[model samples]
Target: MALHLFSSIRGHRNQINALSRVVARGEPGHAYLFEGPEGIGKDTVAQALLARLACLDAAPQAADACGACRSCAALLRGEHPDLVRLARDGATIKIDQVRSALGRLRFDPVLGRVKGLLVESADLLREEAANALLKTLEEPPSRTVFVLVSSKPQLLLETIRSRCQVLRFSDLSPDDVAALLVAEGVAPDAARVAAALAEGSMHRARSLCDPARMALNDEVARFALALGTAPPTDAAAWIEQIAERRATLAQAQGADSDNAEADEEPAARTGKTALTREDLQWLLDVLRAVLRDVVLCGTGIDAASLPHARHAAALHAMANRCDIGRIVAVVDACQQLEQRMGINPNPRLALSALLVEAGLRLRAT
Candidate 1:
């Protein structure tokens, strides 16, 4: 079967064409930093650029990969010897990985004419790893291309950032995300809801389609709504319930790791933890959405403009109970929780603190 190459990517035509022009002119840069928010197509564009560089028919003239060449086939199978991809190992990309990858760059292309290195989540590279990568970027190898994909490009070292051509990617519109989801067979209503919640990320829009994820978001949003009406005792109980669930999940995950086979399918492996930082972020995102709706409702914004249209009743009720000032305060607290979650804070404590604070503020209003 022929390797599948990107024919079209939503919201990235300008960036794609710009890189394609570079390839067609035979003046592609040695290093490019594709920076943007998650799911904004930086990685996708990088892959397309790499495919174009590696494609025999596309090189030196064409703007896109042919997708039928042996190089494209190898790329699809991850068997392209000249192309290297580096991802985070746990939390950071270590110095050793960068050193090895850089060393490989010094060698002649193993199979294809162009050597490509793609480093995902480049912001997660450790200081030593960044320094190591910087050396290679400063003096790149011949016929070699390096692409760094990062959502948090500011976290990268200043010296490293200065060494590469930076391409900025903008967020996709909700309509764009919804159109893609509908094309993928999602119901139009569900697709719109997911896109609205996705905050310009198709990656997040896909996650929102997962029943488990949506259920969790719904439960969290309901909890946020209850804060205005539930008693103090009920709020404490809710916190305890969340803590218990986290602990239970942690124990199950530990057991699964100890007993599961190395070859176990990820879907077959049970006991995925729900209290991860990412999960907490999602929870906060849901809360933020609800708080936003409340603010909108309080300020007499049109109901059609709200993302959580299904929860309009609850949102409007909350809006009636609290003024815009109190709602804004809660939203600010939610934002703080998001920042804290990113910095390795304790999940249970951080979540509980935010919920409790939100509850207190809501009740005071």
Candidate 2:
């Protein structure tokens, strides 16, 4: 089955409306930062904008891609020569790729008057590549448009950001996501939970439609609960957790018993909730989410209103123990550990430090 290209979906009508405003204005700038959570239609917005730019009609301020038009039809088939997108998957967009793509954008379009370069996962650009991108963003080709889409816009350099028009995409309401899911044949209850946990990012929410993501959610819950509530004081309890965590990781990694056991024995540490580096990073992400939810809850942000209420109870409980200020500090600590872990990549030591710090701040009352 074919997926709705962002605006065709019911939940994202408002977003499409906003993008229409940008295009209708015929803004002078050709560079834009399409910022939003994952799967919120940044790429779709970029496409629609690309179509609108090439569109001759001046009516309909909310004018989007004319799906029936030649340009739109070509784009729908992913055959438009005018649309050149650079997306990094599981790696950074190399400096060469960025440079070459920009060079290609300089040419006159094969059919359409305007050309677009949509760089998906823009934040994955390495430092050198990002610097290269900055030059083009500063002085973009007149007939070409550049759209940078990212879930982590902060990863980009400030100078590069200054050159582009920034458009923010927000998550749809749970009611909205649920309605879409139900329309697509998902059960009402399941859609609701996915919407809540997706936290406004429809991409994530849709991915959660799979039963596997639900299992991942459960694992995250269990790990967080054990870390927060269960004190792994002795090496024996730590070993038990190691066994459990390794078992989970093994399944995720699709490891044979021999290989899984090998990684577990040497790399895994004992005593006091020793989390593996991968697990440590994951735990840090989970903890940060928890802290974010704690802040949200304490601020009177109800679970019903937020996306991804899966951990709402945990967030609320933690909020009851700590204030928002403390929660912010905890989040900062988690982010710091995540960076340090990236450089050090020491799971046992990293896990110990993070948990110990968080454990100390467990009760900020």
Candidate 3:
């Protein structure tokens, strides 16, 4: 027998069991809100639930879909007539897309007993689109199920959220993430490192496995340590170095044409190349992780527990050099900078100020 879809997914056993029970009862709710952290398998679980609902051979109380069946084959081919998936076209799901999908859901199932509308990144639904979705959720059609998946569910309309049967998913444990990566042929050491930095997000873990990203992580660790010892006057110079490193990483990653266009657009309009908010945010995240490790080391945590265990010596030295209070102040500054990045037009300037502040805090101790 072929492997069932549910069996391939890792974590979220409680959510899966709840969904399975509903499937077994043959009375799945019309609308479901599957909300969770990104890359924790919410989408995968939603797809599996839909697959089981559509599987012709699925029996009463069956735990999962018959993976070898015709319906399962169609789903695997992305040709399932009864399933309609909606994702962001560019940035938001426009009214037109919602209208189009709603039109399809109005029809009867083409190949199965039920039709499924899986809306990925449902929070990206524009105002008009969300209103249109709200109407459908209020009075959903018979034999149709709607699964709205989002990492940021608070952005969803209250009416829409209230109408759906909400299911919350938690992040995967680091060991679970590492095990999954190892199953996918990642080396044990690399998988462990990626999992530690992933913060329970499998998506981030996979990205961290990229050779370029791994190298960047090392650079970030070194930069964070250097910042702790560097003078406030060097903040501007360090910011410039960060920009150069970002450019190198972008080049190595073969950034897609869309990102390339985005990068070019800003440069053309401003006549100066600046790090995008996303770039700065990623750097901040790395810095935050390093600061966290330093704090943990200072608190007498084991090296194995740190995210950057390979940099244990440096982290320990930094931890010993600066008290927890000073390191925490720097971490707080990094977080505040992250929160203000959206409104602050000059991210580089903000980052420089943060580093200078961090330098002052660390040097004084």
Candidate 4:
């Protein structure tokens, strides 16, 4: 059987078909950008595209690969000489890597019908690296394709952005996520809960299924509940506990494992041994979800819509003790914290201030 492009992807069928049509028409662009949130199947699509472009036995009108072909087999094994996947150096994609890859692109395809370069987490490309990549995109080689995958395309240089054909991937709906989870062997009930909490991310939903991660989320939820009842003196302690927990997680993941959450997140291009910005943002996201649930409960939204439905009672109690105005403020604070975290702020101080403010606001009413 032929290996259809995006055959295993749960969503983005339209996007996949559009690309397939391009391939069938023999009009695949020399430079393309796959922009979307992490774990939303951008990588899968890229791989499939590579296989399609390199398939030896595929017909000119075919939209997929002949799985039995030697080229297709090589692609499946990730050893195709014509396919090159680039990753970050230490924390960013440095200029050196870009120059080197561009140098390789100067050569003709050693095997397969097309030469392909895939830059995962392309947003991590530094200024110099991006400039170098832009040059290549400007005068791209014939019979070659460059696929740049990034969750944050805005981080890429505008010049670089303008040169590529961009394909946007939307988040998967809850129903779609639930169906996928069920197909992956998760119980129906668990799949529904995980889908609700996934925030349209399969990677997040899968992590939510892990006992350890779920326990961590539960601990955060418990702390959010106790904030309404605990004295103000306990604020610092709660913040410290969260920090300690983050530290432990950071240790478990180690410095190089910053992308362990999604595997596609950029590594430290500088080779530093510490948590990347993404790790801090992830913790903030957890807190933000808790605050969002409190707001939902305060506003009388149905429990069915709550991502943390299992903690509905605690959330309701917290909701009763706080006004809608205060809940909004906390959510706003979380958003601000998330944005600020990108600028290299002191994590401990920033997180402490946000949590303390949330605590004070919840008790105000």
TM, every model: 0.64, 0.59, 0.71, 0.65
C-alpha-based local distance difference test score of model 3:
0.80
Give each model's whole-structure lDDT: 0.74, 0.65, 0.80, 0.75
Give the Å error, residue 160, model 3.
4.5
- Residues 1-365 of candidate 4 have per-residue lDDT tens digits of 12336666678888989988988888789988999988666877887887798788988877677887887777667677777888887678998898887787777887688888899889999998998888888888888999999988988888988988999998988888888889989866557657766878888787666555567777876776666455674654655565566558656646544362634546442112344455456566777777788888888887555767777788887777778787788878878877766564466467767777777767755
Could you list the CA RMSD of all candidates, in the order they appear?
7.4, 8.5, 5.2, 6.4
After superposing candidate 4 on the true structure, give the runs of residues whose Cα lies further than 4 Å from its correct spot.
Answer: 1-4, 59-62, 176-194, 219-247, 254-256, 260-365
Measured on C-alpha atoms, candidate 2 has an lDDT of 0.65
- Candidate 3 segments whose C-alpha is farther than 4 A from its true place: 1-4, 36-39, 90-111, 123-139, 151-162, 170-209, 226-233, 248-281, 298-300, 316-365
Largest lDDT belongs to which candidate?
Answer: 3
Please give the clash total of every predicted structure, in order: 0, 5, 0, 7
Q: What local lDDT score does residue 252 receive in model 4, on the 0 to 100 scale?
A: 67
What tens-digit string does per-residue lDDT give for candidate 3 at 229-302? 64445766765676677667667665542321232334311104545666677778889888888999999998
lDDT of 1 by residue, 1-365 (tens): 12334567777777877886788787788899999987766777788788788787775666767767778878878678788888888678999999887777788887666889999989989998888888888888899999999988999998888888999998999888988899999866567768878888887788677564555566767787777565663544565565356446445544543211222233211113344554566567778887888888888986556766667788888888876798898888878768765454365566676677777778844
Residues 223-330 of candidate 2 have per-residue lDDT tens digits of 543343445434234434654665465466454333212322344443344345555554566556655666788889996544336666765776676656766877
Candidate 3 TM-score versus the reference: 0.71
